[model samples]
Target: MQTLEKPKPKYTGKRHRLSKPELLAPAGNLEKLKFAIHYGADAVYIGGQHYGLRSNADNFSFEEMREGVEFAKKYGAKVFVATNIYAHNEDIEGIEDYLRNLEEVGISAIIVADPIIIETAKRVAPKLEVHLSTQQSTVNWQAVKFWKEEGLPRVVLGRETSLEEIAEIKKHVDIEIETFIHGAMCSSYSGRCVLSNHFTDRDSNRGGCCQSCRWKYDLFEDARPAEAWISEEEARESSVLKNFKLGVTQLPLFNEDDNAFSMSSKDLCMLESIPELIEVGIDSFKIEGRMKSIHYVATVVNVYRQAIDSYMADPENYVLKPEWIEEINKAANRPLNTGFFFNTPDHEDHIYEPEEKAVPYDFAGLVLEYDEETGTAVIQQRNYFKPGQEIEFFGPDGTFFKQTVGQIWDEDGNELDAARHPLQRIRMKVDKPVRYFDMMRKRK
Candidate 1:
């Protein structure tokens, strides 16, 4: 056997400190990656086509990853990839090469869960820094120390850890600590639910999560479920008893006043608690939504960027603006809560009824090119909008104005009553100036 000469050394620069916390955003694809960085994310985490845990996302090709990295470089930002899938025997086949490719493509780091993946990256892809995924559920300083000693640069703490515990962890270990400050929460511990695998045959840890935890279910005193409460034989027997009365009645633990029973949680929002999170010495604030829309990415990123800058610029003068809350709510989201931050979430932290999800705004269009002299702007439609409908425009700098949609024209100069077709380019008069990448939304 022959060894290559490039196997010179292992990564020694594992643990370090950044002067300021980075705003880490999720990028499901190349476009979202660009938008997140353009809107002021310090770093963006993306998933490759294979090995990453977002098989449902339009995960990047190596070319797209390279492009994203280059784009982020232009903004002095960074790009990380999520090769964080827990692997089976078959999943290990080409991982070493994949890790090598990631490093070659200039990926700043990788968020990994499986121990084997971490060790492999350290050995085969030493240039790619490894950040432990939240799936490890690192809750204490001990686990953090172990990882830091093992030469990992950072640990994304479990969502269950509160600010006090985070401060304690930071005090004990001088390692980069990342935490999820916003987005969805799992009913199970750090999203390690077996319902997806056991019920729908999709492995959540390996990227095929069904989010079964959010689905509505019927709780019956008499019904035997597939869990340990009932034996498989008895549950199977109960399942086959549809024809026979069996002298048993199924009763649900719900009422008609509500929509239904679901174990789903309210989405997390740490906008108001930014100062506390900064005080805890968190190195990164992660937002969890790789499959979300581009509008969601831009809006959330823009809001957080402004809030963080405002606070860091003047902590004494920092104020949580009401407009920031309003802008964030305009994005598509479930009810917002501070999950496990204040305390263990009670009933108030969950959305038992999906009907509680509030979507007050519809993303209407994206500004492709604005003509200043003619007072016209060309937009690619997202949702339907018609003449005389009230719409609002906003940019990454947080400028927005409400205006009634006036006369619209197609590219062929034909007057249109409505912008009905998706991605249809339409020209319209603008009372205020809008430019490239500005977005328009309609209030519901």
Candidate 2:
């Protein structure tokens, strides 16, 4: 409900900092974990092969967790595992071992919502740190105090907590506090919805959510489906069923003509509120897309990373860059709003219309190897792009530069007019040298 007006910049040339909060990002797997850290995330939260909320995501194996931990340590970054799923009676059998295995993999901490997982980790793995997950919905300072007394060193405050609440929580508890700064939001408070279990056999809490809330349904009453949404005379004037049509160019989830009627809310983007967020004494700033792509992770993390750095470098001179908002939009499909930060979200915050809106750009390629001598890059194609199309190249720290895709050669030296095949390797010339993991994007 808060206005996202840009704060006026006032420069007095005096730079100061309160605290440098950790820039935490989410990673579904090891490659994304590496990208998050390289792109300036101070810490990255990932799900293991078990007990994580994103069960459908490409979670990491123990071996992969170890490798990811080692990779994160290289950049002085930390790795946290998400053991945040609320375990059922049947799901509790081997959770202790999962906790121990995570500690063995050198995870810095585990974000947990279940009491069983938290107490077991505290008892068995005495060295592993535990943070309370946002699923617990700890909005009050008293809840934070209780968790801190229980030996939980950090608490990710619920998305419903406001800036006023976060500052108050810091006053009462000495524990580290984290808040979601960017990404998709759950329709339910703290994600306690069970609509998936009602619609399908899957459990929503234990990581098998089918997102049934995003589906469309026919109106029913008194054991009979309503065939019309309007008067009989109005219905007679139109041949289409209920005079309704599904408003999507392509279907990603449900077949409901009501794509926007789902409980899925607009995404949360705090680019304009970075200064206020920092002023609230938040210990960590978190991003919420474990199921998102490498491009999304890179773009979001890079924007937040730059925003935080610019403000921290010169708080008095800090000004929100218009380009930062533009960069974040490239990765977001849903409209952005400040969720529950200023005031309780009203009707305007809900995604009440058809979603899947078009953006201006697409991730075209990822730089694999760069030839410094010739200013050429060996790239793996992720999307279609042809010669003469303008592409933007960015890296962990690359601002951006435009390069026309003039010529491309395939892996075997065969020339190609366009890089159309998925994951196909190609050698292309760039305007400047790039590094491994740097990526390319083009207008769609």
Candidate 3:
């Protein structure tokens, strides 16, 4: 038999090398936006006053969005505005104008879950790229293909998707694939939970999620009907007890030690799997905390930035640093887990007990301005810091050193023992020189 060589793969399109995946960060406000980019976020996603899911975030006003976009451009970073609410008829009222405004402000992209909002954007702001939000619960390659056909250039896959599934999706779909690599994990399937709406009348779909899943529950049994047990306070508060009636006794769902966090899922973390993620051809790695503190944004973004750059620079010699892991541990609010990335999470992945481990440090202050002549740093206090306390200062360069606060002065130049007020602007003498936007945190 003659051995016939397989025909060379037909080239319908030119082959191109995949570029470095973008490190996408969250920006709840302009301050967070600036720091995220400074710390090495390739792009930042933010919410506006309307139409986004983070109703509690200090979202941008139009003027602020314009300024933020301009500021992001200065660092060669992009800003994506979230208009991802599952809109009702009333919610769609001002969206057309909002889309136009976002385009005018030069937003790099718009994230949407609703078809109507996407259609409106295509009509009103044809220049903006539309990204399918994770709220749409896109799991399969077919759904991604459908979204691509609908004109979206990117799709944020649902949180429950695995690495194997993501690789499969990448093979089938040509559109950019974005997935959450770090930060809080929702208990409900891709954030579609009715508990928040049912318990608090706050629709999780339309930006008013109360996180009902994270609440502790006590199962109670009543001999009388459920209505007899409902008190005035219970009625007013929409008690969870009323939603589910039990018998004659009461049973707490968790042990005494575990009651505080019975339903709380561990936060997602993937620092150890960066190489595998890259090998799988993911287009973007998203950090999911638009409502998190600025310190959280800065620390997480900086560590991930360093990890990505270090691995890209020399993949063969790459070694995960202990310090990088330390930084992440310090920044995390809950226990960390791999989420559903490696395998489906079990009971062990959920935190049933309170987070008892103290944070390694507390965010002390932010250096607003540094005067080289006076050797003084004008600081905005985030937490209480007293003179003589040892604090570590770290910034964009990722260098940190311990320094003692020798002296502190008020805005009036009056001497002070402690910076006690929140957001108080004070001047402090530093033994080591610090730069603008440098963060000070008290060691625990």
Candidate 4:
């Protein structure tokens, strides 16, 4: 590759210390929320049952949201609630009540997209800080400044933005800038696609997205199987004589195929670029999976936590653990990319098939009870754990240590070959101290 030309540097820009930003993960439900906090998240953003995007996600209830806020605070982590859905007249009616409740719950911040919600939050949740969600499409300094003037404390810039652009935007804007450091990539611009609503009446803005972008397709025209699409699976299996373009095209009468783009872009992995992001003046690094499993949440949180800590210890010579990258791959991911961070994305960056295949290294469970006196730890396994298998333990402080199992005993003190049953309690001895939220796994 040829060396690219450099742009002239602007001398009049403001500079800021680019320390490690807060690692923000997503929590679709209470379990995921708790797992992210315990594993290593400095903060987590979640959508409530109403007003936010991600309608299908297992959102928090009033009671759960209250507990979630308290739970995160207990661990010195902040919680931001997303109230970012575009509003209609009906949505505007209950805006005050929504903001008032969020303020009462002591939420760390409110992620807003709609102007009505922003206006309402200022009056109703006056004490609550507001962060502009990426759904608002603040891609440049001008847009970010406009939102900041409206009292937003922070802004999540668009996904398509490059790292250098973000740095430039940071130079021009005074408010905090948060960008998605990891997790799923939306095919549409900043996740504002109307494909779900246009195709299935499920509003993407209201969070009922059916993900039409990832849908499979076969090109066709004139209501007959053309030479271009004759070999398509749908055309071959059709009981109806008429042939039509399948997936993201004009709709036909029988839309039998699951053209919902169910297998979307794999989650983004940025463990390798944590240092670069910090240098770009990002104030918060956001993770994008709220509908993920607790194990998924825990693994991702712990890996990123370790990555950040490693960078802080030695910015110049920090080397991310090979195991940490391995752990991220163990989570749900598509082909990994530096993404727009590198300013150029290859064709392979977009995944068309399935994401990464499932691995056996699922999170087993927590070390619920430990008896350092007896040199044994009581564990509640979320999945099976074979005796003699080695695993990484993520401690309460997010410090990781390696351990090999020696003996396994059931809850009743009977010898067991392995902790293979779901949610089963087992007694095991480790070489070192293992705290709650410490994870164990056997890789495939």
Enumerate clash totals for all models, in the order shown.
Answer: 0, 0, 2, 5
Poorest lDDT segment (10 consecutive residues) of candidate 2: 242-251
lDDT of 4 by residue, 106-167 (tens): 78898988888888888877898988888877788899999888878899988878878987
TM of each candidate vs. truth: 0.87, 0.85, 0.84, 0.82
Tens digits of lDDT, candidate 1, 1-444: 786764321212222222467999999989889889988899999989888777888889999999999999999999999887778899898999999999999999999988899999999999999999998889999999999998998999998998888888988999999999888877677656778899889888877888887888776565433362456456446656552235444556767676666788888999999877876779999998998888888899999999998877776677999999988888847888899888998888877755653567778998999998999999999899999999999887777899999999999999998999999999999889998888898876
For model 3, how does the per-residue alpha-carbon lDDT over 214-329 read when each residue is reduced to its tens digit?
A: 77665544434356445745543544544334333344555555455456788999999887777677889999999988888999999999989887776667789998898898
Least accurate stretch of 10 residues (summed lDDT) in model 1?
8-17
At residue 187, give the lDDT of candidate 2: 69
- Relative to the true structure, candidate 2 reaches a TM of 0.85
Question: Which regions in candidate 2 have their CA more than 4 angstroms from the true location?
Answer: 1-17, 217-260, 358-360
- lDDT-wise, the better of 3 and 4 is 3
Candidate 1 displacement at residue 355 in angstroms:
3.0
Candidate 2 per-residue lDDT, tens place, 228-263, comes to 345645545554633233322223343446443457
